[model samples]
Target: MLLHPPSGTDRVQGLAARLGCTVAEHCEPYGKFKPAVLGSLSGLALTLKEFGGRWDRVERVYVFANWPMLEAALEYCVRNRDEARVSA
Candidate 1:
């Protein structure tokens, strides 16, 4: 999952934890991107690379983020439909 949570709170993280999701923070791969958002296209690519699995084997992705992030996620899903299902 990718999240672009509102600033100055941990509410989203707390909820995700309660929902049994393990949360990890990553630095944005693009210097110009917002530091608080983890759903950028480049960020997504970096994450998948670092995750150390076959990216082509990924089956699902849930993105709770801003418009740009959502668009990028949709594009990724479209390009990898044979391997991934995305909900944003």
Candidate 2:
């Protein structure tokens, strides 16, 4: 799956389509879907462990290969901090 990160969702999706693969946020009930390859592991775990505490302010890229990517996404939310990014 090619997760559509806010910065380039459409581009990723288009690329995945061209490559003849599925792209999605959640893993659907299928025997043929694959998650997007995003990052390494050691990096991802720490990020999730850290950002898990601040859920209200950040969002995550569920298609992460490591905790660092999750942390990075959270950090991005912290940096972007856009009210519009948050919704009711």
TM-score of each: 0.27, 0.25
Candidate 2's residue-wise lDDT over 1-88, tens digit each?
2334443455444443433333344333363322342333233334444544222112232344433444344444434434545752
How much is 72 displaced in model 2, in angstroms? 15
Off-target runs (Cα >4 Å) in candidate 2 are: 1-8, 27-88
Which ranges of candidate 1 are over 4 A from the true structure? 1-7, 32-88
lDDT of 1 by residue, 7-85 (tens): 5435444433433342233323353222122222343455433323123213233323233443343344335643554
Q: How accurate is candidate 2 locally (lDDT)?
A: 0.38
- The C-alpha lDDT values of all candidates are 0.35, 0.38
> Where is model 1 poorest over a 10-residue stretch in terms of lDDT?
31-40
* Model 2's TM-score against the true structure: 0.25
Assess the local accuracy of residue 76 in candidate 1 as a C-alpha lDDT between 0 and 100: 47
Residue 52 Cα positional deviation in candidate 2, in Å, after optimal superposition = 20
